[model samples]
Target: MHLSIGEAPNGAEGGATTATRPRDAQGTNEPAEPGSPSQTIVTFADFGLDPSILKAVAELGYREPTPIQAQAIPVVMAGKDVMGAAQTGTGKTAGFALPIIHKLLPLASTSTSPARHPVRALIIAPTRELADQIHENVKAYSRHTPLRSAVVFGGVDMKPQTAALRGGVEILTATPGRLLDHVEQKSTNLSQVQILVLDEADRMLDMGFLPDIQRIINLLAAQRQSLMFSATFSPEIRKLARSFLKEPQLIEVARRNALADNVEQTVYRVDGDEAKRAAVASLIRDRALEQVIVFSNTKIGAGRLARQLQKEGLKAEAIHGDKSQQERLQTLEAFKQGEIKVLVATDVAARGLDIVELPAVINYDLPHSPEDYVHRIGRTGRAGASGMALSLMVDKDQRALADIEKLTQRKLTVEALAVTLPGRRGDSREFSADAYRGSGREKRGREGTAARRDSSPDRDRSPPARRSGSSPNRSPAKTDPFFSRPYEPAEDAGVEAAAEPAARNGLRRPARKVAALLGGKP
Candidate 1:
């Protein structure tokens, strides 16, 4: 059955329903549809959007409704739980935002202090940038309406967000962590939240925000209208949806967890870790990479790689959670304007970064989870334009690369970089300076899936396991569980996709450098 909104069980007295906004001087739902669709397709007019909101949509150049918006708006306008899975960049925000705005605009009529009224709608984003983007869109859409919106995220001082909260907002957009901080400090109240939206729920799940999300949910009234949007339907996210959504509508615009067809993915297998960097550099230098974002495993790695390339006279910069907010913004702006050739970053830069014409994304280090790999490559090939995503892999990263291949359900062409083996090469110096001092491996801890066991006969022929110092049950080296195992890259059924090098306007594109951080010659 197609994913559609379902009716609530009887005796559900506290649920929210889609209510029309208060009438204007003319008393109409046409907020401002100057050239709006004449009720032929599902337009803001058909969905009962406020005149102010319709005017905002017209001004924003959104003349048509996407498939998701067409299907979702009507159900959401009826005040039912909605679960939508449309592809990225598909204007999914308005599918729910416009309806929510219409339903809440009526509440403003009864408010004694319109300026200080508590927020009626809450939108949870996975990152500050996304939160800001959604707020911008919401503000633009509700410009003519009486709705006031505020965005809150970490990395900035809470004083400003706190002041905004005190000033009272009609719609609140925030990341989970900062939202919880506000709740803890009693700076914001969600007990009156009429509609709750979890945008990019998949990214939130990938970032391990489930607990924080559940905590936020506990503070809200269970009678509120809930909407969830995710790029993929993993088992965990599905479970979360089941617990929260009461017979919710399920909307999937395309296949689940698959990369866009416009994206060209490739994997380059090198002999050693050193070769990985060389391959990346060769691609930039030889291929003439004009604009690129390289994904590294750690903040230190990202910085070091950027600096290393920069010292080699390639323009590059590193950005992560450690960087000051201003620095991060500056780096992002520079990249967007083509001032830098490469922007090296961790997963913080992975999700929700929308660069219209970004040509390439290099996975300097593959992510362990399949979900992360999808997000990392998702930065490019946006807006239905063709783009390239190249991943560098060595012996150690085989498992991670394999996981990525499985997740995408596609096989990446393994291109080997031509390495000139030198006779009697000097012992490789450790690059673990201050700039390189951090573990690239994410700590799975005891929460992740159990470890895999080594069943090879060579293990039985080798030395016995050593006893642990702390307890008799523990081994000196962590033992793989008998059943649960580390990801096996060899056994994966790789996906099928084209890996040809791309050219724009008959130009052989090469990777460009953005910044340097290793404090050494590139």
Candidate 2:
């Protein structure tokens, strides 16, 4: 059974997050007063970490431990295997990184000799963004100590990563594929890795990284402490645990697929594709979401949504697998800097984003995997701040909605949303996404389709206008009905008349009898 601990309060990342603002216990980053709701029972020092590590934590202004941190630090310090299942944005990174850093301090060295530092702890994440994020957290916690950390992922040249690996790092963070690539090149050594962390293991399975994970594990020390973290403990996740972890401690700060109650979720049922885009635009326009991430199910959908929002005069950008790694980083930086108001992204490509205190999230297309629903909304209402989650649902999304409800164990009410678009005549048409409301798109589509079918087989639906640089009287080619008429036998008038008969049909040249051609000059 999943652990039944109550929902984790926001803004407190004992070990959960690397980026901590003055967040109150409820997880919001707002400053705290004497009587503020935030409460702390233990400080980072209580964990008996190295003085330098505590000093670094103090520099970041973290006092209390998040639930995961409170439960995980001691377990990790004890060198016990752990199976941690928590909701997204619950500070899972800090939960594992800190304790691992403390554990590695006894083996840490100040000497710059390449032999002094070895890959002691290895963290495997599902995506490049996530791998980089975990690496950053490790670096932050180990800053005051002699522990060195580095990250390697795909979508970039390997030379730099190869150099870092060769330079020797105590802690290594990498995505499964890139880690394997480095292993193949013999640039990274995993034989001495004592602590193995599979952060977001479920995502790895979802990404089909099981074989890669197994291969990497085979290269690691057999007796090492294994830690597996995921949002849920699906059957597949459980099987993975059985294969790797040896009687690991189970830690769940939130229930399976649990959502942050701090986030307000609203589902809007819309009409057609155009209406969906308009609904997203209207939501952003009407709600004035200064910084929001809109999630799409496909890379093309993400690009299209971002472009459509841009045409609507909204500052938007798209980030997905198709984009080059540099472009993705630039777009993400712009979004984080508030230069881009909307960041449309597909599921896996966006797996690495960690925005602090983001106010809202919008689902342009409901994800086919229900688990992703929880992950997408978890981006907002983070650090205990109240946030909004809005989803635009269409007729075909009913089953997906049902699956989500079944997964999250909550009944989501579908509401009508009015989306307005500029009409063809400089007017505005406001309509609801509810089908029973009879959106104008249905009527217009039926009429337009019938009109096209009834008129010439190939005719323009656009207004009838002359091309600017074409013939003024230019028209479609046509045929004469007379040419298609059936042949009729006329009475033979006279031999001369027949001999010099006027050109018939489309023939203009005269015809001679077969025998006349026998003459040499005929």
Candidate 3:
């Protein structure tokens, strides 16, 4: 089905028809039709949420519940596991957080004792940035409630986190590695966890955290409620859900790998790699984007692009796996605070970033996976905000662009950006089909023959060497003068000849006359 922007492709309430919509703004669904689209517009009060939670929600100016939130909150509050798939920026965090906090309110301790809080709820995320973002959201939603929450992720000192856990906390949001560390050190306990939420489960799997997730699940109580949420649920994710969640109500607010309706995606065609960079700079400068995130395929590429942009006098910083946690956090903080105008990143920063009102997201290099393209652009156009996703495409990236289009189920409009830079090597050149076949060997053989002829002293005057059994008309073999045989003087040769063949045959004497005629002794 073709889904427009802001339209949910499937029923929000999993397979259930909206026969029973949540209460409306007036605290009643009296006039609305069953399963009417208006029935989905729910307020915080309609969910039978705690008074404290309602007050917090109102104070935060959240007038209406998002599609995922409206459908998911009730299911989670009813104590049923939920597997939710929605487009990014669809309020997935709050969908689970509100219900989790409301459920945990009663278990919160009234006393000031350190042992009062025993980690009743656990939320695991794939990245520290995402974990931190979720922690902030949970804290905001639970502002009026007595529930205490702590965030623990790598890249910072754990002393504060340990102290927070020991002092008592009702909710804990953490990345897998750091959470496992706490578990091993006995700094935190998961046995009392009544609810478990795995946010961005697919991303966790992509980051190779499946084993850690399995180990973490093994530590949780078997009787607890489990929630799995992701942008797209691949086969592996479905398998994981089957193993972890017990008959979860599958709620998909949008199609799998769907882009947000509000995000306008475009592909800018450039000539070559250098032109791609040039186009990025031009777009940012021309459009005057205040806050932008450019995605590269590799960490090194991200760093290099960031540096190159800086050389062009633009404020840009890169965050990737190679960077230390401190560096990444510092860069992120600076970007959020507007100290850095452009943030260049890899896919690592794609899922967890919650930048508000980000103007644009540029794809410096098209992601290998179409799912990643969704996540990358999902960084912007968040919370029903209008944003632009511009991809710098060259001829070589046609495959990636095609994959993205197929996955999104929509054709992206392509705009040609005028590239003045010289085209890359071989881009402007053409060759015959057999240009490279047997060419090098043939050229080398010809060069070797010419070199031998040029360097030989007699090659030009002498005939070519004849084989051993050649025709008899060929030139006779030249003799070597020095090593033919041992030879006697002329007088000795004459005397020997005369003695042996003088009587039998007429023998001619050698004429060594010059010395014999001049000497009396001769």
Candidate 4:
């Protein structure tokens, strides 16, 4: 039986209903009365969740629902589409996972007659790392339930994924690209999907997955419940919600693009790249940060920083899109297990990383977008834990810093560092920090121009050379491979050519016959 916490006036018909405006955990429409002592500690059992789910939640040591879970769980259980916006580390996954598992448990038990379970729930994430993380959570949450779950994404063997799908799973978490590949290959079926969740909607769009997302949506059952969770609700996100969600309850646990209050943010000003590197290494050593994540704007920068830190006797590893899935996973696990002291990563590779009680996060480079700054610092200060966030800033980052301050509405305290550090062996004084800070697009454009110039026909030309047996008057065949045939001297084909080798050998056909075949006068 499903739990009905609230009644929709329009009723749940055709998967459409008048959703209740989102309220705080207290179940009131107005924001929980300011200073209304933190939400009464409520257990998963009180939320009307299934016994199996309750057991799993307890095993995970979740004493109570977070503000987001408290508000979103009931709405989802009541069969309402939800648009939840909360700061990172707010336990949004459980908010939806618990209800989804509850709804699928009965169906899973009754559908045993079928050879394989039809997919009933589908969650799409933007990156492979995030997809894997969510899949792990689903497995943990549904441990006691009979429902089976699987995850699929790129950067791994498709054969294993196909095998897993053949056996069937009730819940599937996947990246957009890999999921679409499965749909096209007939390896998975989405026609029976009853619940759909788009986690990190903004990140998916940023990675150019909007069209793929729409195509996947078209393949699902028309009467399915849709839920979307994002850190911020930009105009694009709102537009996407409109197209997919049917009167989704707007739930915003925190202000848009707001940094967590528990995170103490500060900026350290340095002279240049060398100084920035020195500041990060010094801070890590001085603060005794055991497990910390350092964010860099580029993959190359991340790698260089990691190696440089290692040379300074700190254990560090770099992860980015260029790394294989296995390598990325191994590095993440090592970091979590305290085997690696520091994990350096680019923005795209670090999304959806669920590290518990990560003590600190360092931003080696300020992100171009202010929203990204929020996400970076969010890696720390999760689950009511206190954490520190530090950013290494130079003069070039002034504009980006200003944008961040404007978005968060708070000025970050900047401390100047005057210490000097050893420069790279091959570093030249002529190289400016701005040279390394160019956007990826500009670098690609310059490389493309150089490639075109190098491949030009004129640049590839070599002085003509006479062949050993050919006459000096004879022109060489055109070297352009795209031409239908080699160029020939037109005069040699006229009537005067009748006196050539073929005529001398008495093997030429009569000109009148050729003319008749060609339908021309002789």
Across 321-370, the per-residue lDDT of candidate 2 in tens digits comes to 89988898888778878889999988887786777768899999999999
Tens-digit lDDT string for candidate 3 (1-522): 111122222212333323234343364443434433334345668778899988987777678776677677878888888888765566778889998998988887778886888888899999887888788888888888778899999888889888888888989999999999999888998988999999889889989999999999999999999998987789999999999999887776654665667888888865445556667787898889888999999988888788878977899999998888889878888888899999999887656776667878999999999988877887677656688999987657899999999988899988756543322333322112122234555653553355454435674356778789889597768864434546657556655554665545656566674555555554
Please give each candidate's TM-score: 0.69, 0.80, 0.74, 0.74
Looking at model 4, the pairs that clash are none
- Candidate 3 yields a Cα-based lDDT of 0.76
Candidate 3's C-alpha runs over 4 A off are 1-41, 260-262, 382-385, 420-522
Residue 332 displacement (Å), model 2: 1.4
Q: What overall lDDT, based on C-alpha atoms, would model 4 receive against the true structure?
A: 0.78
RMSD of 2: 9.4
> Candidate 3 vs candidate 4: which has greater TM-score?
4
lDDT of 4 at 296: 97
Reference-based lDDT, residue 380, model 1: 67
Per-residue alpha-carbon lDDT of candidate 1 for residues 245-288, written as tens digits (9 for 90 to 100): 88886765444555767878887665444445656677787768
- Least lDDT summed over 10 consecutive residues: which range in candidate 1? 1-10
User: What order do you get sorting by TM-score, best first?
Assistant: 2, 4, 3, 1
Better of 1 and 4 by lDDT: 4
User: Model 4, range 1-522, lDDT digits (tens) per residue?
Assistant: 111111111101111113322343364443343432223425567678888888888777777666567667877887889988754467788888899999888788535433558899999999998888889889999998778899999999999999888778899999999999998888999999999999999999999999999999999989999999987789999999999899887776555665667788988776556567777898898889988999999999999899889988999999999999999999988887889999999988998876777889999999999989988887777656789999988778999999999988999987655444542344322212333334645753564465455446786577479678878777667753424445566755644543465567888777553466566885
